[model samples]
Target: GAGVSQSPSNKVTEKGKDVELRCDPISGHTALYWYRQSLGQGLEFLIYFQGNSAPDKSGLPSDRFSAERTGGSVSTLTIQRTQQEDSAVYLCASSLASSGAQHFGDGTRLSIL
Candidate 1:
């Protein structure tokens, strides 16, 4: 992908349903990150992956949230039993290295009804 690409730019789901969001990072980038931004709230880091290392899942809100990166490239985030509080913009970003600035995608707007 040129920059980062995320699927289903807008998603509307009923409460308790599950939703999966996808992200394709830029070529050759080694670090990928997922973040969530709620209305009037700052971006919150959800997870981070660098190469074959263990993913940093420190910021996932609950047990229902999970993610995985394949081949050190594309990534997917799944939210199970979605709640109204889950409505937010999920953003994906990638960097050449963990210490570099990240390039962000437009984000997936998930709305739990």
Candidate 2:
């Protein structure tokens, strides 16, 4: 895809379940970021992955949230022991550099029952 691409656009699961969300950044992009947006709220930075540097997982709310970028391309976000609070739209974005504008995906709407 020419832009950021996310899959499993919608997901439903139980509170104790675990899920994985995937993202494919545009080719040649070096910076990738993950964000979460709850209904009625704006996006919150979850994590960031930049070429070769250690992933910035500081924005993650807890240990259950994690992400990784492989070869500076595809990335995945994992949520363990999903809770109702975890329900939100997971957005992925990519840019040529950290300071440039980003291109975002449609997002994955996750629902925890």
Candidate 2 — what's its lDDT? 0.92
**Number of the top-ranking candidate, with TM-score as the measure:** 1
TM-score for each of the candidates: 0.96, 0.95
What clash count does candidate 1 reach? 0
Instruction: Go through the candidates in order and give each one's C-alpha lDDT.
Output: 0.95, 0.92
How do the residues 1-113 of candidate 1 rate in per-residue lDDT, one tens digit apiece? Answer: 48899998999999999999999999999999999999777899999999999999999999999999988899999999999999999999999884578999999999989
Model 2 quality (TM-score)? 0.95
Alpha-carbon RMSD of each model? 1.0, 1.1
- Per-residue lDDT for 1-113 in model 2, tens only? 67889998999999999999999998988999999998776789999888999988889999998888887789999999999999999999999884688999999999999
Lowest-sum lDDT 10-residue window in model 2: 94-103
Q: Stretches of candidate 1 above 4 Å error?
A: none
Over the full model, what C-alpha lDDT does candidate 1 score relative to the true structure?
0.95
Which one is best on lDDT? 1
Error of 1 at 41 (Å): 2.8
